[model samples]
Target: MSIIGTIYEDVTTDVLGHIGSWQWLVTFISATLMVPSMLNQYEDMFLLEPPREIECDVSASSSVFNTSLCTYSVLNGTKVYKCTTWHVKFLWMIWFKKSWLIFCDHKIKLLSTTIICRLGLVFGCIIFGLIADSFGRKLAISIDVVAELGFRLILTFCDSESWFLLLIFLRSLFASANIYMGIILTCEIASSSWRTLLNAVVSIPRMLSAVCLVPLANVAPNSETFNFIACIFSASLLILLRWTPESPQWLLYNRGIPKAEKTILRAAKING
Candidate 1:
């Protein structure tokens, strides 16, 4: 067996011989607290998109304007006037439209921002995966959570489209890291018998987070207020993570058997 595998076996056999309360506690906390982070990250796709139905009014022309087109022709003339304002249906105040002024002409730019933010999910997995292996799962999750919250809060105040897109990209990047590393830590700390069940439990929050957003969006006055409420949830997760224990598997491989043993004992104490 490899070094980590050997250490994992020893810790599971000699120290954490059976599933205990500490394992269950970690599983529940991680699963519950993760919902907010998942919602905050995944909601970007919905929020970045412009409302489906839009109509434009021309100030100087009495022509019938096509809702699909960005510009319209006058009744008796060939002059095409650009739409300066839009009448949007469904969601009237999405931050993407209000803050950036991304009308029909700027649909491409809106799509680009959505694509860029989503790309963070792919990169965050690869990058934070390495960080988890090298540093420790606990540290990796903590750093990502802090970064995610910081970027999200900063994004609320951003006025420029370029800066807003950049913040959303970075926010998504770290938000993914928080979830990825959190799952890793949860699995690493859990016993082999409990691993599959805990993983399933953790995944439930992802679906629930999406459901939760429906109510949140309806209650909040605007997109900025909605974002602020989401950030509050992220902040609460940070606090909960403080009591969470590091993975004995990671400590054994990186910090030697003594440290790993210490962590196991501490968890045992908590379990008792």
Candidate 2:
């Protein structure tokens, strides 16, 4: 809990200190490290003895993952299926709640979610890439962010398991699309030569978040709070709208120079 409190405070301070750069640095680093392996660094340290419950925990997590994956897929694209939202929310509760309060709850489910989160993230990025190329970076960013926000809000308020499940499905659905979208969209905003470097830099946060920052999740009280932390992280990235712009490619292709200039300038300032 202390760890999470410190990180939570640090995130706030990081945001205030570097509206454009440092905050994003943290974001980039964490997002770059967005794999389960990053946070598992210490499991071997303190809990190395491998508690007896670990086996049961692993088994349960696997089962939940398998089951939920199906549930999420079925309802994610279907807005009419209300149960989808509930399951999604439930996953957050299971993940962030870290409930010793429920079935085999310890680090198992959290670890599983952390593991799967970025897998979903990877797919999300790819989907966004397509959107950016087809629909335009600005539109992709806006749509992804809005959908992300809506999912978070819905999950945050949902009280029932059914509601939470649906929320989780919605969040994961969009998030899977968002990870790649952020990547392709940001790249579109940069200069051609610089695109590679900036795009690479943007990926740094997934790593940092996963490795250096995510363990703090262990310090948080529950899944709900963790979801909020993740939400804040996502929102911070979205707030880049003040500085973000439609990719110059789209502008160039569309033959809009004056329009592309400002976005180019901002990218240069931040990324240069």
Candidate 3:
């Protein structure tokens, strides 16, 4: 066939055929970075308003009622009256509890925020897929990391409910895009024999990251602290990216033989 095709075939057969340091390093970094991205995307679930004891005052009568649900309370036995003043006992200061007074009347709005965040995931996949194909996997991942970090930082300081919703959507959008891009890059660089195994291994970190959220939430004093810690963890990926190489397969198709050859040689040297 063509010169590029021959070189690509040789590289795939020779260099990638062996499981080596370069391949393992890339997979480890990519998988580890997925932790913060996932935490940022789904932290809202953990931050949802916890059940609270609510004491409501009845306007017409002197009777006060205590309930967990902030809806109407029975006064004597048959008379149901709407709650006027709310005495809410918060177990912890979370995003939902501190902001967006999501009582019984406004619980639907909280659900809407989660739905909007999920919608962002759908859009992120489509948009970033186009970006990865058009530009490059590395560029797409870099953009996703930076954008997710920026949105999350802003979200930490967000007080307004409207802004919080918007930031949640944007944050999840970019965070999720990195997941697929990382997977694609890893698979593209891996040997055929190792692809399935590497894919499964890489996914393990994602599950571990989800589990980590429990300790992270408990350790942080509040939602802002949780987000700040997540940001700090995410920032380390920037340094890791310095050692991360572009996919040689992508270079072969998009950037021609020379670029791909250089990457393959670098990987070989590192692997050696």
Q: Highest lDDT among the candidates is held by which one?
A: 3
Task: List model 3 lDDT by residue over 1-272, tens digit each.
Answer: 01223355556558655588888988887787566656754445554444334344344454545443444655576655554454433333332223333344466776787789888888888888887777677787788778767886787666577788888888778777666666777787777678778777778766766666566555544456567667777777788778777777777777667877888888888877
User: Candidate 3 has what TM-score?
Assistant: 0.75
Poorest stretch of ten by lDDT in candidate 3: 93-102
TM-score of each: 0.75, 0.50, 0.75
Off-target runs (Cα >4 Å) in candidate 2 are: 1-127, 189-196, 233-238, 254-258, 261-272
Instruction: Score each candidate by Cα lDDT.
Output: 0.65, 0.44, 0.66
Better of 1 and 2 by TM-score: 1
> lDDT score of model 1?
0.65
Question: What does the lDDT read for residue 87 in candidate 1?
Answer: 43
Listed per candidate, the RMSD to the true structure in angstroms reads 5.2, 15.3, 5.9
Which lDDT tens digits does candidate 1 get at residues 1-272?
11333548566545655578887787887776567566664444454443344455454354654434366766666667676554433234542333233434366776787788778777877777887788777776787778867876786556566787778778777766656555666777776666788878877777676666565444543445556667777787787777777778877777567878888888878767
Better of 2 and 3 by lDDT: 3
